[model samples]
Target: MKYWLGLDCGGTFIKAGLYDLQGNELGIARRNLAIIAPQPGWAERDMPALWQTAAAVIREVLELFGIKATAVQGVGISAQGKGLFLLDRQGQPLGNAMLSSDQRALALVQAWQKAGIPQALYEQTRQTLWTGHPVSLLRWVKQHQPERYRQIGSVLMAHDYLRYCLTGELACEETNISESNLYQMARGRYEPALAQLLGIGEIVAALPPIVGSAEVAGRVNSSAAAATGLLAGTPVVGGLFDVVSTALCAGLQDETRLNAVMGTWSVTSGISQTIETGFDHPFVYGRHAEAGQYIVHEASPTSAANLEWFCQQWGMHDYRQLNQWVAALPKAGSQLLFAPFLYGSNAGLGLCASFYGMQAFHQREHLVQAIFEGVVFCHMTHLKRMLQRFPHTRALRVTGGPAKSAPWMQMLADVSGLPLELPQVEETGCLGAAMAAMVGTGAFPDFTAAQQALAPRLESVQPDAQAQAAYQHKYQRYQALIGALQTLQSGHSKEAL
Candidate 1:
């Protein structure tokens, strides 16, 4: 009757899932996250509101299943990476947390690139400069909000902030911080020189001590216990980045297999035993859920979120009709194209989301199809880059909202010319976090063992030989358009609109 609890805080939803040791999902509950955007190109979440949302869902799941708080073994969390979540000098929330999709630091990133900052540090950080990175946002704060910068007490990402909320202990999980550009990749620890290099030397002390994935971060204190229905002193493990959680749940049994996550961000990742660098385009590396391993990836804020934006605008919530529209269209003959960069871009800085080559004959369905393909195309851009680094890559383990669609999954497989692996994981973020909890609570020796015992059923979507040829041609057009668009992006800013 032992159980593990996982809380997934995502940009779109705050989900809580309860699972047994055998990986059976006992219950799940979710609440849509309300993103606060006071200015254009800004995405934020109120800290207190976020914690309340998480508490509400956690309580709902426990009550809905009638599970005793004492019966739950441990708790783990999985959340979006690289957003600025802070606590001021009094250990109170500073302001609304900046999301990974926020573009307020676009000008700073561009300025740094012109100064060859990213290029100079790429050998050490192994990450390209991005507007949404914590360093970028922190620099923006130090220059623009000097008072708040001086008042800084601690700097943390979304998951770290949540872990602190649960346990009242200040810790930085290694996996998420590895991608923050504040940590030295090769040395596998925080280096103050990196902070100085990024122009935020004063905030070095704010970086908390690092903790391993399966280690006990802290226990749920009385405050969190009363807020949520959990018992006091329930152990909480150092959680994971959502992508890391998804990879473990997707059954990435070996290095040959890759994982693609399509959500608020389109992330393509592969695991490596040793760190590899020296790429023309730097691939971001984060500490793996497993000790001594690394997860190398390329990601952008271009994915199914595009559909969410359309849903908000058109006032439609369901996906069946959109899939049907895309399903009706033939794959190869469409002349329309879409750049899925509403939130962020993979091509380069300051790229706007747009539909190109639209004709009078195009209908709403055609536009929907273009959106699907545009998202897939953006994912492919990252996938193609990853394949160069992971040349031995064999299969893709896919997950996320878009993967639920047969038409969309088929498009991804056909475009990549590789077989798509769909694991029977309903909530990857939750299940992945549970895996960490299981390990921390001594349910398994490590993540690999935990996954093997709870391995999910598998479904495969193979590429079509005929469709692959057509997709190769279509992908060429997508690449050409991206090239043209990048050329026209000189001095442009997404926030300018």
Candidate 2:
């Protein structure tokens, strides 16, 4: 039987899997990858080491299944969005990849915003001035590492870098390219004007050719085949940013559908044909892998990361135990508040995880519950913004690590007052990549056909009306607290400016 491969390159791991065209998952392999913290507010990955690990995992999966390299039809990639992986003339990684958590780019993004660059940027890309975006990181590189920047031949994200390593061609997929802040969303292409504004136009030759997320990127190289155990002539498709692929895999393809992907960070996205954005409240919109469609996304910089942080602080080991302990607590266990800004603000500023309203009687359980509540509350804020702007969403599809927890899924459903549908496949990013491959390889007539065939069975979770009512009251308090926090922030900004 023929098989298709889907690979997911995440911040912490590289996961690969083999599947049939009918969506029966054969096997999945995951290998841990390291994130190097060279300095505070900066995260990176050793690009060469990561590539080797990816190949190792792919080879292992194929061997385990007793399948030859020639049996694989096509390959698709899905990776964490943002970050920069610079390549040299010989297609070698120049240095460690600058991760999405890196803040060295913040100052440059701020300067662009001040110079009216972000305004033009928003008009083109629907993005705000945020750190970890490629535009900000690229500008930082040009200003701070001119010598190293001079050697750069092309810029690729995590998956794009992997694609280049496997295929000799260098190309950027649309979903990730649009997040670069240098790509024009409406026009669906890179902006030369923005590159000139940043004074990096001379090196524009290094930028990857932008292509559809499901388009054929290239054939595998002999070196890649030796390392990954894939056929040399096997086709590799341009993959997508994790978010877009997750949405597609979870069946959030229509304009009226939305998805909540819970991982280290929580991302909320929807499929929209039109761009819905504004000054104070706006979202990044970009073209979908499926032609004529666009994706509208809002992200909470930290969700599971905050949970992980709290677990460490409390010395908890198992998350299942942690969940049970928190669930046993009374609803709204403590009066404490947590803003969950461990990764800084993706929305607005001053969202740091707070322990406000804490009393002398509170314990770790209450604090943990408070943090969980705060994360869910923050998600609800995004949901409100999304629904208000679009107002046509049918249901919210929830996917990823946290979605596996019944308590967490139900709590989110209750807090958001929407039904949460969990995909049959927990790893939608990988499955989405497989779907893209199938479409690109002509196993299916079109993206819609591929989606229909691979769209997993969705497990439904509905809000408990009583629990929903309780969360509604807490949500009001949450809004009031956010307002108060914003006032404090304004006062502080006034002093600083």
Candidate 3:
């Protein structure tokens, strides 16, 4: 029997899944990845360590299922987007990989906003500037670590680096590179003009050739085959950014349906045939995993991670128990609002996760509920912004950690006043990666055919009218609170100066 291997490289874990051509899961394995925060607002991962973990997990899944190395037909990767992974001329890492959540380049982003660099780049790339983007991180390195920047020979995203380790090929996948701020959205390639505007044109030569997500990048080299128990010369496809992979796996084929990722990021996005630009707020227009499509999104680090943090701090190790506690709580009357910005904010870099109206009478349950409400509110904030462009959005395909919680899904439905559907596959990113492999290996004609054969079984949830009304009132309060906070923050900044 033929099989494919899908590897999803995430912020805190590397997951590997073995799947057949029909998308039936044969086996899966995962390894925890450690992020090093040597200083405040920094997230770094050991470059070699990441590749090792990925290789180990792939070997584990293959061994567990007792699958022959020759039986695996193809491989694909889905990884966190926007993180900068640099390699020197000899194909050695220059330093640690900077993650998507790293905020060390906050000052650079702020300076660019002050200097109008963001507006200039936005006109060219249609992507909002962020601290973790390759442009921002590259500029940071150029300024702060000139020696390392000068020696850089290639610029790669997280997945690109992993693919390089496996296939020894230097190429950038389109979906991830589209989010790098270096790519010209309209022209579909790295824009030297944009890089010049960002003052990093000197490194444009460092950018690798772009390849479509499903295109065969290279074959598994002998070393990689030995390390991962895969046959040498097995094809490795150009993979995708985790966002696009997950969205595709959730069956986001058209523009009418939105996909909400409630994991480390509260990401709300939809596929679009046309690129929409010049929004009042920041929204990303990235190339979708599927060719000839765009994935427009409003994303922020405001989702299940908040709940994870709370549980970890409080020693609530069991997720089932935590869900039971949250499920038993009364609905919609907590007067408290959570900002859900533990990682960062869409509002601005200065704003953080907060509770607006905590009272002495409120207990831990109220706080827990506030976290839940806060996360949904954050999703609503992005969804409302998206609705301005995609008013035809009929329903949402919800995925990630929160989809495992029934009460959380219900709250999301009530808060957003939209129907939500959960995909049967728990690891959408891995499944999407496998789809890429299938297409690359000729198991299917294209992504569309592969998707049709592996269509997910879904469970639907609809809005509750009374709960929606309550949330509507609370949403107004949430908006007012945000405005007040922004004003107060602006005032403090002025006062400090």
Q: In lDDT terms, how accurate is model 1?
A: 0.89
What is the lDDT of every predicted structure here? Answer: 0.89, 0.81, 0.88
**Local lDDT at 200 for model 1:** 94
On lDDT, the candidate that comes out on top is 1
Tens-digit lDDT string for candidate 2 (1-497): 88889999986778998989898888988998887888877888998899899999899899998988888999999999998999987788898899887777765666676698766667777876677887678778888888888899889998899988898888998888887877877777888887786667776778878978779999899999999999998999998889988888887767677888877767888887777545467577877877888888788666777887777777887878768977897675456777777776544554445667888888777777877788888777677777876688878898778887777777898887788778889577678888889888999977778888776887899888888777777767776787777777778767977
Clashing pairs in 2: 153-206, 154-206, 339-354, 340-353
Off by over 4 Å in 2: 276-280, 313-315, 480-497
The segments of candidate 1 whose C-alpha lies over 4 angstroms from its true place after superposition are: 491-497
Q: How many steric clashes does model 3 contain? A: 0
The per-residue C-alpha lDDT of model 3 at residue 340 equals 83
Sorted by lDDT (best first), the order is 1, 3, 2
lDDT of 3 by residue, 306-398 (tens): 888888798877877667867887677889888888888877777777898988998888888888888888788888988888889899899
When 2 and 3 are scored with TM-score, the better candidate is 3
